[model samples]
Target: MTKTALSHKSASPWLEDMRRRFRTLPFLKATGNTVFLFIFFYLYLYIQRNPVFEVTQIPATQLDRWIGFQPWALALYLSLWVYTTLPVALQPDLKQLTKYGLHIGLMCALSLLIFVFWPTSVSAAVGPREGGGMFAMMYAVDTNGNALPSLHVAAAVFSFMWLQTIFRSVRAPIWLRVVDALWCAGICYSTLAVKQHLLLDVIAGGALGAVAGWLSLRSAGRGKIAG
Candidate 1:
């Protein structure tokens, strides 16, 4: 009985120490960026839901259709970035939150502009015949509005190229960077597997994300975080 009591006492100190460490790192900052991100996400849904934003389906041409194949197909992949970035945003006062919000805002602004000016949609329509593929859950993703500048590919490309600097200061080793890279790569690939976006959209998204990520890292400061 005494041995059991002693073991409990011994671990209590370590557990308490861990608790203290965790308490230092909060989970959410709830800053302007947080509010803005929520607002923007809502606005995205609103734009899609509104009848004002019509879904314009594209006609299939031979060259454009062939984008479905390999070599070219590789560029279309983008799932991991979609899933992972939000989780990162959940972390507390990382400063990167604001940076991310800014980049995301730029994407949204660019997309919104495209939506307004070009006002186009994908040629492919996911209807009753549309398969229950990776994006099956998001089947509502019809060819109505929201087509130009694929946010998925853009975000992944943005994160991959930009966050490398941030991760370098992350205090992790080479293996961790490699793992993170794979995760980023997966995010890029997942976009296509899910079929939520097409090749043209992905390419545009990549460009936007890349530019945004670059600007974000630059604004985030010279790779040196205080405290």
Candidate 2:
């Protein structure tokens, strides 16, 4: 019961609790993901703004014409931020959580590399959106040159693929799974409806996301075998 020992023993419960929570898997995963996102965003914005790389416009296919402009889809499109992060917070264990984080980081890195080598932009087919609102604001900041691999679509597809297993493990109802699929589908379509990406961009991004998700799951499976 030395003086310094007694003082340390009486440290505030609030501070102790905060420290404990920050050590949890969810908190650490979130912090790491946030940092990665910030760095990725900086690089992405830099590429978009760079004037040296010539922008290649992706042409619209017949399907792109059928999709049409649905300015309303913007809501679902932007929901990607939530959908992408929710699963990480709900992760059941540190081991699985780490795997998911690895997958996401790899996917983002691969996309960034592609953008550096081949700077592609959405075609002017849809032209400039004609009003002032959320959509307009998005257009203002979301410059061209990030097309070909639609990160938005990739994220939505990735979220859907990974979260499906989580939800099923929790015994969520069939209806919930159906809604999840629909939401992801909406996000994929939103990329086209708003003309932020062409049909080809969505396809390529989806393929990339699926591959990443598969590889991540495979790695987790191998870990279980080793254990």
Candidate 3:
């Protein structure tokens, strides 16, 4: 067989296996994601509206200034909600699905706690004018508080880690893995490009996400998803 033909043959089984998993308990997975996300947003909005501590503005770094505001990045920034659902939706069984939830939930809980205690906000001058359009709506609803350890970046990173593990376990193609990485990177960059978060916030959020994802994978006693 030609090398290209051999490669395709080798890849077919894993691709078929992934398709079977996606067909398992589809309704339950969708409901779980919807309910958990609703709860998360409720808590997040409540904390944003009522901070326990005095709100502090996050100071911008030179890096923050260097990355100019890009209005187009709002698409990537908002895409985090959809991106996060992928990991949970792909879980092949209830056990793995629950574990994913607990780990991600804990990470989010920690970030919310920090938001309540520290209560940080980004300066209004950093981003686009909130006079009208989607930016105005986002600014109106998601007002700057909960700035440090941005849950947005943290969630994106956490999802990326889980997706990476799942993809590796299924022996997914290299191109699929590249798309996953690029999507995650775009979400991270969007947080800054949209001026919703400062450099320190993104750094801290990335660290928090990496640590949580690493610990979750380690404690699960395996690096890849259950086959």
Q: Against the correct fold, how does model 1 do in TM-score?
A: 0.64
lDDT of 3 at 222: 53
C-alpha lDDT values of all predictions: 0.54, 0.76, 0.85
Which residue segments of model 2 deviate by more than 4 Å? 1-26, 222-227
Question: By descending TM-score, how would the candidates be arranged?
Answer: 3, 2, 1
- Residue ranges of candidate 1 with Cα displaced over 4 Å: 1-27, 30-37, 51-96, 125-129, 133-136, 141-144, 225-227
> Could you tell me how far off, in angstroms, the CA of residue 3 lies in candidate 3 after the best superposition?
26
Deviation of model 2 at 12, angstroms: 36
Q: What is the TM-score of each candidate against the true structure?
A: 0.64, 0.82, 0.91
Q: Which of candidates 2 and 3 is the stronger one according to TM-score?
A: 3
Report the C-alpha lDDT of model 1 over 110-203, residue by residue, as the tens digit.
7776766566566464222244453344546433357667766666666666445544544435675586578776656554444455556667
lDDT by residue for model 3 over 7-26, one digit each (tens)?
66776876776777788878
Off by over 4 Å in 3: 1-11, 124-131
List the lowest-lDDT window of 10 residues for candidate 1. Answer: 67-76
lDDT of 2 at 90: 56
lDDT pick, better of 1 and 2: 2
Give the alpha carbon lDDT tens digit for every residue of 5-118 in model 2. Answer: 887689764344334433557658788778878898888888877835677888888898877778788888888887787666656567767777778888988998888888
